[model samples]
Target: MEPLNNDMSSIPDRDALPYRDCVGIAVFNRDGNVFIGRRKGSDDPERSADFDAPWQMPQGGIDKGEDPLRAALRELYEETNITAVSLLAEAPEWIYYDLPEDMLGKALKGKYRGQRQRWFAFAFTGDDSEIDVEAPGGGKFHAEFEAWRWERLSRTPGLIVPFKREAYEKVVEAFIDIPQRFTHV
Candidate 1:
């Protein structure tokens, strides 16, 4: 065997992997509690991380030429069937997270390493009857949540998968003042 050369071409470029651009929504009700959903089913084995918490806020990919704010609203309506909302706040910056090693080349159709998310906070003005996770708007995608509820924004980090906890924490911190500004019915 000949001596191995330090050719950079032989090494895979981790930066070459693209991160899917996506958006997340944290819809808050009258009491300032943010919406959370319990994912409908068990892990796909390939895409899911080993975490007990299934609850998370509404999130999805940003379509071609679609604005991040628009994508946030669209994903919110498509996932929760609620539309009566007013913008509360938007995160100061985009948050990025990577998939676990086992899922790196399998999740998201192996198209990207993970997601780069733009998170938005909205005030839910509609009544509870407006929410129907089973049949979302336009019906483009299947129901992602089996059960849903409103939770304290601060507690969200613990309820999400470990890999996504940091992003959730930042979101909560960025919007921490939201409740004080909109406490009225």
Candidate 2:
């Protein structure tokens, strides 16, 4: 295998894969409740990284030519019908996590481990009723969260995939100054 260069021109061209680098926004309300969702078909609803199902913050793909902040905003509206929320704050750079090898297809396997994700923290400025994962292009292809709720954002890091844990820890630490960080937005 050859070294992969992030440089746009040096990379060899190939068909696109669905699993790409992305930005995941962890939006919360004023009540100290961090935003979370139930994956559509997740076998385990209350899954931890060590189990079958686990709750998580809102996140999505970072399309080419899109900055992580922009991607975070786009995914916010797309997944939750959250159109007018305020950007309380954001992480400095990108956070990455990889899909399990078994979950990959012929197309997804050739590239990076999984996704290089950036997580943004926001306060929900709109009504909670506005969250509608069914709006249009939603739901995970395999695992899906069954429900959503607001919880302490500080605990999110220990819950996601092992590789993503560090990113989770870093993001929450950066945004610690925000009051309650999760609550009525």
Candidate 3:
């Protein structure tokens, strides 16, 4: 009998795989802090290590033919249950990130190599009571986060998975001035 070969080289080239189209939202509160959520770890042991740094902004796949901005709004409400928000700014360009070699064929349902994201910054205008991580999207959508909190924008990159750090850094740069704008409003 032959043993199973669990080699990565046997898989297709990761660079050749397509990136998932997605939208990321930076929901800033009146204090200028951005929202972050601790991802709910998967039951798969092979993928458990991916949650080492689970905190992330609200993000999700973009529906076919959906406008990027609308997708951002929908993802925000679905993930955080907060509808009172106003657009602050948008990243000048899409940011791309590749999954780690080990995660390439294991993550994103073994479909996407990573994500190509359009990011938006929004000023959260509702109270804290509106935020619900346990049963987001009015319980219609699967809960992606187990807990959530407001964090400093500059610190986000360090809080997310290493493979997605660069993307988070770019998002921070693109919306760096947004928080300050709310200070005087």
Best by lDDT: 3
lDDT of 2 by residue, 114-174 (tens): 6667777787777877776655234533223446777677877765655457767877787
- lDDT tens readout by residue for model 3, 19-127: 9999999999998999999887577322276457888999989999999999999998888888999888889999999887877777788888889999999999899
Candidates' RMSD to native: 4.1, 8.1, 2.5
Task: Assess each prediction's global lDDT (C-alpha) against the native.
Answer: 0.85, 0.65, 0.87
**Reference-based TM-score of each model:** 0.87, 0.69, 0.90
- Model 2 gets an lDDT of 0.65
Candidate 1 deviant stretches above 4 angstroms: 1-13, 43-49, 138-140
Residue by residue across 1-185, what tens digits does model 1's lDDT show?
99879796633345778999999999999998999988877655322556777889999999999999999998998999989999978899999888766666666777677899999989999999899888787566589888899998999999988778888888888899987766775
Counted clashes in each candidate structure: 0, 22, 0
After superposing candidate 3, which stretches have Cα over 4 Å from the reference?
A: 1-9, 42-47
Query: Deviation in angstroms for 122 in model 1?
Result: 0.5
Ranking by lDDT: 3, 1, 2
Please give the range of 10 consecutive residues that has the lowest summed lDDT in model 3. Answer: 41-50
